[model samples]
Each structure stands twice: as C-alpha cells, then as structure tokens.
Target: MDIVLASKRRRFVWSVAAAITAVAAGDVLFYQRGAYGGQTGFALAALLLLAIACRPAIWRDRRAWVAAAAAFAFALQMVRDPGPLPWTLYWVAAGMTVLLPATGTFDDGWRWFQRLLAHALRSVVAPVLDLVRWRRVRRARSQWRFNLSDGLRGVALPIIGSGVILLLFVAANPVLAQWVDRLAGPGLWELDAVRIMIWIVLLVAAWSLLHPRPIQPIMGTFDGSGELPLPGVTVASVRRSLIAFNLLFAVQNGLDIAYLSGSVPMPAGITLADYAHRGAYPLIATALLAALFVLVTLRPGSHTAAIPAIRRLVGLWIGQNLILVASSMLRTIDYVEAYSLTGLRLAALAWMALVGCGLVFILWRLRGGRSASWLINANLAAAGLVVSSFALTDSAAFVASWNARHAADVGGRGAALDLCYLRMLGDSSLPALIELEQRPDIAPALRDRVRYVRNAVLFTLDRRMHDGGWTWHGERRLAAARAEFPDLPARLPMPAGDRMCDGRLKPPPAPPAPESSPLTVAARP
Candidate 1:
C-alpha cells in the first residue's frame, strides 16, 4: 500500500510537470525563435524520460525501450538543426504530439502525437475494445451489448474521417510551412492571415468534436415553475452539428479572406507575422465560444425553453443582413459616385430601421408574455423586409441612378428615362439603345449611352448591326435621330436636363418670373 501510494503521488507530480513544460514549450515556439527548437526538444525529452523513470520494466521491455529511443532521436534532431528541421523530424514530433495522453497514464511520452493519433485510435481500436468489454459484461446480464451495428454505424465513420484529416493536416504542415515562409517574405500581416486560417481550421475541427448539440435545463423557469426530469441531447449529434457549422464558418471566412486579399493586403502597415499573431487568439476564442453557444442553443429542447436562443437567432440574422448590405453597397458604387443618393440607400435604411424596431418589439413582447404566434409573425415580417431590401433596391437604383447621372449628356431626362426603360428590360432592349442615337430630342449623353450599350451587346452576343433600320416604337424614333447626327461619338457627357440630382428622383418645377413683373407691380402699388 505504501509502494502504491508513492507510485500514485509520483505519477501525479510527473503528469503536472509534463503538462506545465508542454505549455511553456508551446509558448516559446510561438513567440520566440532563438533556441526554440532546443527548448521544445528538451521539454518533450524531459517528459519522456520522467515517464520512463517512473516505470519498472520500461528500461527492460523492447517496445518501451524503443519509445524511449524514439524520444531520444527527437531530442537529437532538435539539437542538430535548431534553425529549421527536416520534414521527417517534424512528422516524428507530430506523431509524439498525438501518442501522449492528456491525463493519468504512464504513456505520457506518447502525448506528443495525441492530436493526430487519438481520432484514429478512437475510430479503429476503440470499437474493438468496447466490444470486448461489452462481452465481458453482457454474459452476466444475459443480453447482448448495446446494438453493435448502431455503435459501429454512429461512431466509427466520423472518428475515422476526423483521424484521417488530423493526420493529413499534420503531414501537410511541412508544405504549409514552406508556404508560410514564402508569405513571411512579404512581411508579417499576410503571414499572420495564413496562420490564423491554419489555427482556425484546426480549432474548428478539434472543438466541433467536443459538443455538437444544444444543452437545455430540465427546469425551464428560474423559479422552477416548469421543472421536469427529461432526457436531454446526445453528445455525438452535437459534435456532428458543431462540425458542420464550423465548416460553413470556415468557408465564409475563406471568402472574406479572398475579398480582403484584393484590397486590404497587409492591413495598412502591420507585418503579416504580427498581424497573424494578433488575431490568432481572439479568432480561436470566438470560434470556440460560438461552437459552445451553438451546441447549447441547438440542443433539442433548448430553443423551446430558453429566451437566449431566440435572441441568438435574431442576432445572427441581423449580422447576415448587415453583410449583405455592405456587399450591395459596394456593388452600387460602380453605378455612381458615393455622395449621390441611390434609391438603395433609402431602401436599406428602411429595412435596417424596420428590422431593428422589430427586434426591439420581440424583446419587449418576450418579456410581456406575448404568444409565440406574435413573435413568429414579427420574425416573418423582418425576414420579408430583408428580402425586399435586396430585390427592390438592387436594379431600381441601378437604372434610376444611371439615368439621372447621365441625364444632361444622354438626351436630357427624357432620353435618360428611355435608357432606364431599356435597362429595365435587360438584354432584350439592346436594339432600343442602338436606335436612340438617331432621335433629335435625345440628349447627347443619352444618345451616346444607347450607342455604347448597343455596341457592347453586339460585341457580347456576336451579332451583326445594320447601318440604319427601325429598332421598335421608341427604338425607331431614336435610330432616325442618330442618323441625323452622324458626328456623335460613342461616349456621352452627364445629361444636365434630368430632374434627378443627389438622392431625389422628382424634377423641380420652373421658378416664377420676378424681375420682369417688378416694374408693373410697383406701378400698381
């Protein structure tokens, strides 16, 4: 008993020591470069040696001896080339990362390979161990272990896929390292983005496995008004959902990165490395928090019982719409300058205000014991507003702004309106634009715009154009006008005649004559 107690105490101390050292080593690897390799090597070697020293036959048994030898080899590789080690050595290190366990075990030397190997072992070996253990227990119960096929069907494939990905990621790290090094040449910000992407992928994969479903209270009310014993969510389903959500998040993040890469590049002046480091912790933390939140919210009864779930869904919708708004805003700018008012701006503002007010209303209603139907109707209205913001805002502003801005040069506001009308018809109205150049009443801007659009369509569709022909009702009038002014060029100035200016579309009325009547008014007075 004394010997056993001593063994337990020693094991506890070693485990604590290994963990502390591993953490310190990881920090050094992240922040420092000089002797970082040596530091990591020493940390890993110390843990391995301590594990072996605590064992009785580790020195005697060949497999235990081999593990120790591998640990020694890792230390040697670390010392030999401290700058940048071989790919194989990194693989060896990665293997060690997974083989080691997190908690109580003499095999802590193998913890180095923990991340890569656990999923595989969980996939392939775990079921076998479970089966054997179940058989041992089942004989007494006179019933077979929980359906073998169900166990295999549910857990087996996911574990294998996860393990495969983890290992592939580790193995691909050397390739990733090369890319990182190349990016590092551009400075740290770009490099940092790359690192952030790497860590996010890893984190999303790892934590998604922890809990995939929502977890709700058995007692809904704070005062225990609706307390009831009930079975809650399963861990496996939650894990799967978390994985799917993370994957979706990663794809969106990748799109963001692609978009930013074209414009932001190095984020003002920060080095890619520093930039990457700065964001790494926060992004990982947020993703983990989100995963936890999603898991809890998604748990089968959690949405029904919890108010927070409703708020979360609303918040997510708001965020998604905001992103859509920003994208639409960018696209709108190609049609006009920023200061000019596009109908989209009004539509977007209206949508935002309505949604914001509705959200506030829901919060208020939630507190006031309103029926679920009220809340549902409110949410549905908000969703409709979101869709309307897109459809009503995109093309209407495009055509109206296009007409207003080019009104002076196109053919006054009238010709500009004609172009707007043509645009509304999409590709089918190309002949109208071609015919617009002949109209004597058409503003030069409108005439030029029509011709340019006509040519663009012809080029795009590879169609032949005749010198003079009636296009259609409006098209025939414009074609005749263009023929009368053959000197007109393809480009037209902004038509000055349109009533549209800045944001407003309606034309102002003519001002009353004042000076000419002043003398007559004076005589009457």
Candidate 2:
C-alpha cells in the first residue's frame, strides 16, 4: 500500500512538471504578444494543457466541458474588449471551473459558496506541501546522498576570500577596475523588482491551476426539520412586523405620488431638487434592507414561511418595495433634470432597475417554492447580462450627447454648457462638440472653446485610428462625427481664455433702436 501511494505521488509530480513546463512555454509564445491574440492563444493553450494534465478525469466530466466553454467565452470577451468587468467575470468563471469536478451536488447556495471558498484556499496550499513531502520521501529512499550543508561549508571560505581579493585588486589598480567595469555590463546583475514579482505571481498561478484541491460537498443526513431559535419570530410577530413595514412604506409612497407625480404643489421651503436628491439613495438602501429581512424571516421551509397570512404579507411588502424602487428611479430622473445628467446618475438608474427585478424575482421564488440556489443563479444571470450589455455600450458617448443637446446655450433646459466636462469625455464627446460649434446662436467665446476641444479630440482620435489603438466602435463613431462637420477646417484657431466658461465676458447687448427721422414725420403730418 505504501509503494502504491508512492507511485501515485510520483505520477502526480510528473503531471505537475509537465503542466508547468507547458504553461511556461505558452506564456512565452502567446501571452507575450498583444491582448487579442495573446488572450486567444492563452485560452486555447490553457484548455489544452489542462486537458493533458487531468487526462481521462477532465475528459469524462461534463462539468469540465462547461468550464472550458466558460473559459472560451471569457477569452472572446477579452478579445472584443478588455476591461475590468469582463476580467472579473472571467476570474469567477475560472474559479468555479477549477472546483466544479470536486464539489458534490449542493442543496443550497450558501453551502455551495462555502465549499467554493474552501476549495480556493486549499488549492493555494495543498499542492506545494504535497510536493515537498514527496521530495522528502524520495530523499529518504536514495541509496547515496551528499549533504548540501557540508558542500556549502567547504566553498564558503574560498568564495569569501575570492571576493576580498577582487576588491583589493580593484582598489589597487585603476586599469583593473576600468577593465572590470567594461566587462560587467550595466544592469547585468541588477534585479528588476517588477519583473521578479510578475514572474512569482505567474508561477503561483500556474501551480494552482495544475494541482487544484478537491472540495468535498456537504451531504449530511440531518434533515432541515429543526426550527430556528429566534424567540420573537413567531408567525403572528412576523405578520405584525410586515404590517408595520407596509404602513411605513405606504406613507412614503403616498408622498412620492403627491409631489413626484406633479398632482399637488410641493410644500414651502422644500424644492423639487431637495426632494429628489434626499430620497433617491436612501430609498434604494431601504429596499435592499427590506429584501434582506424578507429573505431571512421567510426562508424556505421555515415555520414563518408556512403560514398563508405571513406569505401574503411578504408578497404585499415586496410589491411595496417594487413601488419604492420605481419612485427612487423617478427621483433620480428628476434630479438629473434639475442638475445635469452624469455617469453616476445613469448607473444609479440602472441599479434601481436591477433592484426592482430582484424584488420581483424574490416574490416569484416565494410563490413557486424555488430553492435558494435557484434564486441565486437567477440573480447572477440577470446581473451578468446587464453588465455584459453595459460593457458593449459606449456609455460615455451617450452621456456626452445627452448633455450637449440639453445645455442651456442650446435652448435646452439644462445648466450652462460644461465644456470642461465634455473635454474630459475624450473622443466620445467629439461629435457633440462639432454639433455645438455649428449652431448659429452660440456665443463666439464658447464656440472658440468648443472648436479647440473638438480639434484636440479629433487629433487624438486621428492618431489612435492611425496607430491601431482605436477599436472598431471608436473608429465608427469618429467617422460618423467627422461626416457631420463636412466643412471643418484642418486646423482650429486657439481659444483666448483658459477657463471653460469665462464669467467676465457676456453676450453683446442689443443695439439701441434708431430714432425716427423728423423730416419723414413732418411729411406724414
């Protein structure tokens, strides 16, 4: 049995070595290239290497195929657009793929999450320790051995003496020193801290990929018939709590309907801006907390969840939460209208929509008696779809265009034009700036600044287009913007002011009306 275990350990070592070599080679050949080709090659190489290392185990497991597909999808996304969101999704998907074969069927999302965390921790530590133990055993079984300590002791004095002699020679003879300097190239022995750190990280990542530890799924026979030990969580108490919560939410909703719906005048000293800004974020927080409470109190298979009255109350509460989410959205819209629209406000609106969807999903789960895992997966899918859509959409361009059209100078309801903000939007705002420049009513000062900004953006876009830095979407947008201003000059005149909006300069006042001629009046008489 000991020999058999040793044999298995040896085979594992060989497999790890092979995988490491393959990964290192692949990194050198493919990962050293640019993002698109590099990511594509690395994904293919990684999947192939994993297949070779895991062999029949990976080949037979259906989960392995799923993991491979996910990896491919991640690579495709990176090739399309490499950013934080796509990378985050790739890491999560890759982590799950590494643990999928080891974990058993989980009964709940919590348990599955717990096992995944454990598996990640174990994968980091187990492989290296096991390799160390195997090496120790192999050393014990060797027929002959040389002590590394004794060998180092034999060479230490000579090495020290040689270093001292070299220093003495360099100090005594300038020519020798000069010769030494000439022979020793600059940075030959110098360490690059960044490169060293990167290599170390890569090595560790490769090690983890090669020897992932298995996670044993929790399969305890203890049925979930036991009740939670909360003393005040009886059905009646939950019902009362839900009723109070509903009434409190109703009051807030009523105020929203009165003020936000434009049906009644706002009270004195309370502006619409104040009303919108104060409640948008806090209401979203309240909805989140309410969702958490419902999940905990009315957990599946719980006694509180079994009561029909409590269930009805929970559904009603969820419905109220949904209304609150809508009101929060309206508040955000109102705020954007009063102020100016920004990326954060747009994100807030999207987040509110997601929250509303989550509330609806929760009510559906409760009605249908779905598992926790189901709810978790459903929400994850929803979030992933939203994020993926956002990744493809150029949000900066949308914000820039909206702001441009709504600026006060353009006969729109928004505040004074923010050329600085538009400039910060980079190439995405070029089209809007061009459109602003073409308007006849635009002040000369503002138009000059707009032309300056547009030219700067166009220069950047032109350079990126020439240098292959611009993506297809960027190129397309630039082409469209250029088409709008067909007669734009090749060069723009510089603006006189440093500030975005010079407060000192105002629009020229209308010329005084000319007095009527006296001769013409006498002729009329």
Candidate 3:
C-alpha cells in the first residue's frame, strides 16, 4: 500500500512539473513568436513533454511511432510556404497524433474514430477530476491541528463581525478610511477578466497535455454473432430488391452510354452542354445513394452477404457505379470544354476521381471479405496522398498557364480569354501574363490589361524580394518571369481614352483651367 501511494505521489509530482513546463513554454512561444509560430512551438513542446511524462515503453510502441510521424508532418507546416491545403493536412495529422495514441485497432473504422473523439473529450477534464479526488483522499488521511470544517465554522462569525465593525469604524472616520485605503498598496498583482480567462485556458491545456487519460479500447465485433440482425431483410426480399435496383440503374447507364459515349445524339432541343450539365451532378448523387444502399443491405457478415448471387450483384452494381462516376467525369470535362475550367470545376473533377477510386475499393473489400476498417484506411490513405500532392503543386499556376494557352486569343481552340480572371489569380499568373503580352495578334485592350497586371505582379515580386517574404519556389518563378520579360517596363502607362481612372488606368490630369474657372465663377456671382 505504501509503495503504491509513493508511486502515485511521484507520478503526480511529475505531472505537476510537466504542466508547469508546458505553461512556461506556451507563454514564451505566445509572447515572443506570435500565434502561428507559438502554436507550432507549443505543439512540439507538448509532445515532447507528454512523452517524458508517459512510460518509457512508448518508444517501443507502434502507435507511438505513428504519432511521431504525424507530429513530423504537422511540423512541416510551420516551415513550409503558406497554403490552405497544407494547413488542412497539418490539422488532420495533428488530430491523428493527439488521438491515435489512445485509439485501438478496431475492426470498424467508424468505431476507431468514435473512440478517438471519446478519448479527446475524456482527456480534457479527467486529469482535473482525478487530481481533485486524489487531494480529497490525501486530506482525509493527513493529521492536521484542526479539521477544515471545524476551523471554518469557528472563525466564520468572528471574521464577519470584525469585517462589519471595521467597515463601520472606517465609515465614521475619514483618516482611518484613508489609512486603510493606503495600506492596500499598488495594484501590481491585479488581473483583468481577459487576462484571468487567458491564464485559465492556458493552465487547462497544459494540465490536459501533462496527464492525458489512457483510452480504454472498445473490444468486440460490430456484429457479435458475425451476422447482422435484420429480421425483415430476408434473402428473398433482398434478392428482389437487388434485381429491381439493378434494372433501374441499368436504364440510367444505358442512356449515359448512348448520349455520353456518342453512340446516340442528345435528345432534340437539348444542347450537349445541357445534357452534360444536367446529368453530371445527378449521376454523382445517384452513385452516392447506391453506395449507401450497398453498405446497408450487403454489410459484412450479414445473412444476405453470404449469398453468392447477392454478392455478385453487389459487385456488378458497384462496377456500374464506377461507370456512372466516369460518365460524370466526362460530362464535367465536356462542360469545362464548352465553358472554361475554374478552381471549383477542377475540384469537382478531383472529387469525382476520388469517388471512383472509393467505389473500386468498396468492390475490392467486398470481394476479399475485408473489414470496414480496411476499406476506410485505404480510402484515407488515397485521399491523404492526393491532398499532399495538391499541397505541393502550384494549381493556380497550372490553371493560369492552361487557360492562357488554350484561350481563343492565344490561337487555341477555346472561349475568349478572361484577362480579368487571370489578373485575379495574382502573382501565380505572372508568367502567363508575360506570355500573353508577347503574342502578336493579342487584342489592344487585352494587351493593355496584361501590361497592367504584369506591372502589378512585378511590383509585388519586388516587394516580396525586398521583404524576404518569397519562398524558394516563389523566388524561382519570379526569376523565370523576369528572364522571359527582360524588357518589361517598371510601371504601366496612363490610358489614352475616356476610360475610368480606377487605379489600373491612370487618366491624364485635366488641363490647367483653374484660372478661367475662378474668373467665370466670380462673374456669375
């Protein structure tokens, strides 16, 4: 009993030390480096501090290694160039690092995620509650000169009465009140509400990090008997539904093949754009619904999942869904070609690709009889890789270059160039703008716009260079833009026509008619 109590005391002391260290580190990071840098610093410090507070056995644990890797991924965000995608990925990695240590290897991916959430919530308050209980137990055993309750009761009335008498005496005498007020000293130790709240939040976070409660693994299969309990969903009813669902889906697939694949012309009064736009979104929605239905009816270990015919039908249905996803992609491509590609359209294409991959994985999992956990991890891995790739890629630059070259103004086969949109792309489109300006047959208005945009980009580049704000990639691109447009002017010329002088165009100043205007105004008066 004594050994156990000693060990508990030691652990508590260590936790207190870790908490203090974390709070100090947090304060230094916040006050010195600013919030973004401070957050990154605090995360790194807290991770190290927590590892120290935990058992040394963590070094040999697989989850610990995974957590370390995730922490490294998050650290990359602090030093890398600023990007929304990378920041989002960093947050995901950070969450995994924080939660994965407590999450167990569950057969259900959703269960694992749920456990992570539960652990996070428990960790936030569990330490404080445990500390309070420990203090109460310690107090109960300690032999003090007086019991806390008895001491308080004995002094309560005397303290109150002394306070009342003191107030009355101070009210009656101005000198005594002045002397009491002077004794209060300066407000050096005073804290405002905001400061108090900040300290409370900081301490809470520090304590939570110092003593995170271990998550209890939720053991047991999702379907304990290795089968779903659906009394109404018999083999025969499911078979009928599968047949009807397949037929209904077949009709949609047949039309997609005919119209999307160019086997038959689109219906009269419907342009290709109309057909493509109308089908793309709804087809994706249908595939999503079909996927949901498959998961529900043919869930692993279910009675219907054991039927060979049903399994085959589910696979076939999944394949058809993949085909539907492909059709949606083609439709989006057709629409993009008819119109133009924006960031949103590009994102839609990426999403469709991910959906197609997900459907394929679902079929694979069903065929292999794998758990939902496997399916989920595979999809997450694919998605993480895709997002990481996009984070590293300069999508804006690629879009700008593609649009610049494909525009009708550039002698390619597409709609008219939207210089305004390209200009909105900012510094990433600088090289494309420079290229646009070099074209011989470019319209005069577009050429002027390009020149204006190019000047703005150059000015921005120069400022970033001087301020040391350009990343390696930005610096390299700026160098390339400079090399391509060696003779590009430093500033744009004023517009010659009756155009508005809205910053982009510097209209010529009105002639010096002030003298004549003043004489005419005086004569009229």
- Top model number, lDDT: 2
Model 2 bad stretches (over 4 Å): 1-62, 106-112, 115-191, 216-226, 422-444, 454-525
On a 0 to 100 scale, what is the lDDT of residue 96 in model 3? Answer: 48
Please estimate how well model 1 matches the true structure, expressed as its whole-model Cα lDDT: 0.42
Instruction: Give the distance in Å from residue 139's predicted Cα in candidate 2 to where it truly belongs.
Output: 5.4
**How many clashing pairs in candidate 3?**
0
**lDDT of every model, 2 decimals:** 0.42, 0.69, 0.67
Cα lDDT of model 3 by residue, 161-190, tens digit: 998999899899999988876764323235
Model 2, 1-525: lDDT tens digits are 667765566557566765566555544433432223224435544644564355445656687667656656765555544556656655555656666666565355455566666666665566567667756765775642433345569999999999899989988999998887676533334456744554455555555555566665565322322256577777888889999999999999999999998899999999898999999999999999998887777777788888898898898899999999999999988888776788788988999999998888888877777766677767767777787667656677788888888878777787777777887777768767877888898888778778777776777666655543534545566677668867755543344444333223446678999998777445565
Off by over 4 Å in 1: 1-247, 250-254, 257-370, 376-398, 403-420, 423-525
Q: Report per-prediction Cα RMSD to one decimal.
A: 27.6, 12.3, 10.7
Which structure is stronger by TM-score: 1 or 3?
A: 3
Q: How many clashes show up per model? A: 54, 0, 0
Please give each candidate's TM-score.
0.23, 0.68, 0.67
Distance (Å) between predicted and true CA of 379, model 2? Answer: 3.1
Model 3 TM-score relative to the real fold: 0.67
Q: Looking at model 2, how many pairs of residues clash?
A: 0
